[model samples]
Target chain A: MRTILFLLQKEFIQIFRNKTMLPIIFIMPLVQMLVLVFAANLEMKNIKMKLVDFDNTATSQEIVSKFKASPFYNIIGYSYSVEEAQNSLIDNSADLVMVIPPNLEQDILNGQSPKVQLLIDAINGMTAGLINSYSSMIMLDVNKDIAIELMKFSANQQLKQISIKQRFWYNSGLNYKHYMVPGIIVILVTIIGMFLTALNIVSEKEFGTIEQINVTPIRKYQFILGKLIPFLLVGLFDFALGLFIGKLLFGVPIRGSLFLLFSFAFLYLVLVLGIGLLLSIISDTQQQVMFLTFFITLVFVLMSGLFTPIETMPLWAQRVNIINPFAYFMKVNRMILLKGSGFFDLIREFLYIGIYGIISIVVAIRLYRKTS
Target chain B: MKALEVSHIYKTYNDITALKDVSFNVAEGELFGLIGPDGAGKTSLIRIIITLLLADSGEIHLLGKDVVKEYKYLRSRIGYMPGRFSLYSDLTVLENLNFFATVFGTSIEANYNLIKNIYSQIEMFKDRKAGDLSGGMKQKLGLSCALIHKPEVLFLDEPTTGVDAVSRKEFWEMLQELKQKGITIIVSTPYMDEAEMCDRVALLQKGEIMSIDTPQNIINEFSEELIEIKTPDLYEVKEKLRLEFGKNSAFMFGQSIHFSTSSKSKSKELLNEFFEENNFNIESVNIIEPNIEDCFIKLMTKDS
Candidate 1:
């Protein structure tokens, strides 16, 4: 709309002219990209593990050797007693502990499986869970070694049958930045568009200029569009910059169609811009806007499955993601850049985001126009 | 034709009745004023007329268009400047004007003449951010933005509450000039002196219209005998006056005691006797005409 264009132009001017907000928006994304790309990873190449080997047998030593050989875990220190192991865990000197009881070699020769305890600090549920799974798998290999030797001597046992079709579809390697950069871009656009616009509008109302605009012959749609356009443009500009940096720095690929990325991004911007306007209308001051903005964005980003797979989230959060525009775009961004998904691949998301955009704009305009 | 009209408007924010059965109208090309102190529903009523807010129960017509129904139409016809300076602080004076003008499907050049008188003052600092402007300059900039669209109605809600005295004076002068240009102006202010500036004023108290007429007519309705009596010990003298001659509202207006009496005949000997009884020296005593502030006090007393 013409009103939308005017609003967009005004928003761009404010973002450019406002000295306090320009750097916060323009520079912070790049800075965060640099920090996060290095900081975020699931590979866990250097986890410090402690060994409390009470048995000191060949088998126990072999188990420790196998753990140390894997790229995921590293044996950092040794402890003799449970107290020392617990102390190491509490002090975060070790992430995991392998405790072997005495006479473990005798028990394995007596045809009894020696019980080994793996104490893991589950406080950081993600890393702890991953470490536990890896530790369990390594134990299976040790048990197989014991079984193979026993089987050759006795000739009584049979090998078990296990089948797993582990096919990693889109990102087989699971490069952290491949998964991380796209989702981060989604959240980045969301933060810039929603919070910044909310701040800009509430600041006007706080200063009493909202009343001046309210009295104008300008339509409510114009006012709402005016509030939206600048942030949307800034959001898009930031989007391109983030995309460029992702390509140049991290070597992220944009496999998705550029048209599809821009199209859905435009739709998502509309949805978020409506939300920003709604927030501005509901808030009495800029402080409230900022607080609520932070809260909403936190919820949106977390629920978007930026950290965990959407398949891993609880059904409730997964359902809520349907309403979250970022959830869809996080997928779209990944599909487009990492997976090189086409327009047809993201058609459903594009439709939903468009619908969300239209509904939100309508509701925000209807509710906000009254305050004019 | 009526430029603006409201009939039996009742607006309540929960338990607080901001406007109750309030009705008033402004004729075409008239400068009407809603004069009241803070919390008198001045802003609320102005917001409704501007179509930025809606009345809980009322019929409002702006330029013969229904405010609630034809809101979009109403908005295009009215210009509002709220009590507080609400402009884009980051934008310069010119940017604010141009942005607003663009919204109305018009360019600043198209409406520049309408705001030429007020805009010229701040035009030199068009590049300076609005946040850095002086209060007077901000006020002028707000006026320019509101007038840039050249709406049929201009609703100014306490536009001069915090500006300096000279700025306030200049603002009223500008209003007078705008009135001559056939813009129906509805100005609200808490300042009693400003009440006289409007062609007519409606004194509101507790969300109700107490009185409405020309400023002189409202003052002329003051039937009580008002006198300002000062004594060396004014507090002591006021107590004595309240005891003897304060059956009518006796209150302090600055250093003097302004108290009314049932009749002028009862006041002749009482002021001197009250001061003597209170053991005070009389520096001055004279009969004075009631101003809008006094009328408002009287109205608030009656409402209470």
Candidate 2:
């Protein structure tokens, strides 16, 4: 135990003495939080639209005015020629173009459905799909109004309709930042916990200091724990700072118990640091550790549902995420912060991460040799 | 009991053999040296004995404890200073020393007397970072850290390989002092002069022990008479001598050429007549006593 304290003291001194590392530890997380939360948003707004109406009627004018009033579409201007509107789409000036053909009011009055054409840019498949849906909904509303008005004048009968209302359960406003902030916090803690621990021992190996330590009476467990505990505390501290930034900057709600959130975070950190230790044991130099950790962390973050929904991914990918530690924490972070999930709600994640942490650490200790 | 014992130790890395059937023993309180150039398997042998590396097939008994089977208990009883500067460079000198002391489960206050003579030399710079120290000072700090635990056997691999002459002298004196405290020291170096300071040394060359004995005995064991030829053209004289008498007979030693031959009486007369016939200016030619280096070259060439 005394040996471990000495080792811890030595490690902490080295960690703090590194001038370049201090800023990375304290400031990089806040920068990542501020930048990635706002930049990684999928919410689309201010979609530029060009309207080409051939019919100079009140019905055509009403549709143009409705498109202009919606918050999502930014109407560029009215074009008389359909060819000119299509040119705007080619030049990327407009994301969508709506062309109403001639005789649109006469066709509705004569009980004929007039063709309303929408030309949308399909470069980004996702945004194009959203634009199609929004424009279709607007047209549907316009059709219903005309039908009701025509019925009132023709016959004294009321039209029966079924209206649907939507209420978003957790994120009422559908704030993308609120959903992203917690997930970015998971990434921040993971970077600190895994990268630092992975590079720590390998740097000693490069410096030839580990050989000196190997000859001493210090047990393997003491050495491993000494390395693990300091980074664990640093990771937790970074996690807390991330939580504070999430609450203060993004106004992300922390509805669940803070204690339960931190408890799971501690377990997840252990699992991550354990893997780092395992990497360090297998690697011989800092460069090897850096490349290995970078590759693994990149895969973990990308497959973790940080940017995309895991359910929407292929079936094999979802199965692969069962072993991804980052996915578990990314899910639990949102669950506790957004949905107000309790300990019992996250029991399965807790069990898997706990078991993973034990296995990795035990394997690390078993592989570490005093003599080779 | 012997401080260290090895029998037929062998080690290899892939196809490259590092130590080949190497064996030696160090008595208690003896200052032993493993004298060889780089890649002479000096570091490999020391690492195996200190329980930092495994031998391919061998039996090593350090203080009567099996090195492989009982490494855990033996680790506390031994101290090793690797060839590289292994102390924490980012740490202060005092912090580095204190850390090693604590790691061995002992305080500096407990082992203060053991490292005092060496530690006091750099105690004034205790606050300085180890990386900022000079090469000599770094070596001194490494030695101090190794001695802080007061182990039964201390293994130092090339402690004076890159140190200045004055500092190298001082390091040897410190080792002698440590020997007086009843700690067996096994130090390796490529400098032939340094071998004279050890009580006994195993002259190693290319993964094999050439000879093992006291420095005087190794020198006395040179079977051939040695002749030192001083001339203005040293390289030419060496080449001429090698062409006349085989490749292993003549080699450059510092400022002169040393030629070894079985016939001491006739060789000097023959060399003078030959130099005169070749129109070469000879400064002096006299039979000289062989040093450790001469004995090493003779033994190394004999094997090939």
Candidate 3:
């Protein structure tokens, strides 16, 4: 343990003394948290919708007004013909074209359901799907109004109609930034833990200092632990800074216990640090470590449900995410911060991350040879 | 017991052989030197003995323990300075020294007597970054760090390769002081003059040992008489002499030709007659004693 303390002291001195790396370590995460939270938003807003009302009726105008009032749609233009609306959509002026039938009010008054055609631009498939669902909700509300009026006139007070109401439990306002801040914070911690440890060891190799250390009586496990503990501390520090920024800038509430969040972060950092050390052990130069870390981190980040939901991904992608530690942490961060999840609720994630940390560290130890 | 013992050690990298059936031994408190040129397996041999590298097949015992099996125990007792400047360049001199001492489970205070002579030279600038120090200062720091643990044996690989001549002299003086403290030092260098500083030297070449003995003994073992011939055109004199006495005996040595032959009297008589007949202006011709460089050249040429 004394030997480990010495090694850790050396590592910290080297890390802080490096002029180029000091700013990167202390300030890069804050910049990423501030910028990425705004850029990585998933909420679909200001969807441009064009109206092609052929009926010129009260019901059609009411539906159009509802869409315009919901804050989700921007009425770009009103077209007299379906062809004109199609032109507007083709010119990128509108994303949704709503064509109401000529007898929309007449059909409703005669107690017959009317048909409406919605021409949606599916270029962004996810956004198109959302627009479709929102437009259908507005039409359903108009139908409910007609049905209630008809039921009162017919004196059918016992008529039954089923209506579904939605209540967003955790994020009532559906703010994308609130959900994204915690996930981005997870990414920041991951980048710091993995990149720094890998570069640290590889730089030692480049400078040929490992040979001097290798010849000493320091045990391999002791050396590995010494390297891991310093970076783990740095990672936790970065995580705390990210959380502070998340709360200060975005006003993201931490509903869960702070202690629970930190303990889980500690476990997750061990996993990331193990991965970084393994990468360093396999690489011979700092440049190789940098490139490999970049490629692997990119893969983990893109597939870790940081921006998209893993459940909606293909089966193959979801299967690959099982080994992605970032995916597990991203999920747990949201669960704990947004849903007030407790320790027992994250037992499975803790188990997987712990096992991964153990396995990666074991492989790193096995591959790191004292003799060459 | 011998401080270091190796028999029939061999090492290879890929298809290239680095150390071939090599063997040597150093007695306790002896200053041993492995003298050879670059790529002559000097660094490889030193690394293998220090347990930083593995020998393909061999036996190595240091301080009466197997180097491979008891490496952990041996490591605490041996100090190694690799061929390159391996200390952290960004760290201060004192920090680097303190780190190595602490890792060895010892304190700088414990080993102060051993490294004081060397460390005191650079102690004033102990706060300077190691990379910012001069080449000589860096070597001093390297030596100080290596000796910080007060190991039983010190392995320095080419400690003076790029150092200035004055610094090199000072470094050997420091080593001599350490020898007085009964610390066995094994140093390797390509500079042939350093062989004379060691009690015994092993001359290595192309993964093979050319000779292992005291520098004076190696010089005394030269069987041929060495003749130094100077002339206006040394290259021409060399070619003519090679023609007369064959290529094995004649070599160029800085504006003079060293011609060796079995019969000195006959060679002298022939050199004067041959130069006169060839219309060459002879400057001086005398018999000179051979040094380690001459011995190594002879040994390498003989082996080839």
Question: Pick by TM-score: which candidate is best?
Answer: 2
Give the winner by lDDT.
2
Candidate 3 lDDT by residue in tens digits, B86-150:
99999999999999999888889998988988899899999999999998999999999999999
* DockQ, cand. 1: 0.54
Which model, 1 or 3, shows the larger TM-score? 3
**Of the pair 1 and 3, which is ahead by DockQ?**
3
Identify the superior model by lDDT, candidate 1 or candidate 2.
2
| Per-model CA lDDT versus the true structure | 0.83, 0.92, 0.90
Which regions of candidate 3 deviate over 4 angstroms?
Answer: A50-63, A78-121, A142-160, B229-250, B261-265, B268-285
* Most accurate candidate by DockQ: 2
Error of 1 at A126 (Å): 3.0
RMSD to the true structure for each prediction, in A, is 3.7, 1.8, 3.0
Superposition error at A31 for model 3 (Å)? 1.2
lDDT of 3 by residue, A1-372 (tens): 888888888888888988977897789888998789988767778999888898987878887788888888899888888998998889998899988889988988886888989999999888898898888888788777777878888896956877688999889988888899999999899999999999999988999999999999889999999999999998999999999999999988899999989998999998999999999999999999999999999999999998789999999999999999999999999999999999999999999998998898899999999898
Clashing pairs in 1: A7-A226, A8-A229, A208-B86, A209-B86, A209-B87, A255-A340, A256-A336, A372-B52
Quickly count the clashes in candidate 1.
8
> On residues B161-200, what C-alpha lDDT tens digit does candidate 1 reach at each position?
9888999999999999999999989999988779888999
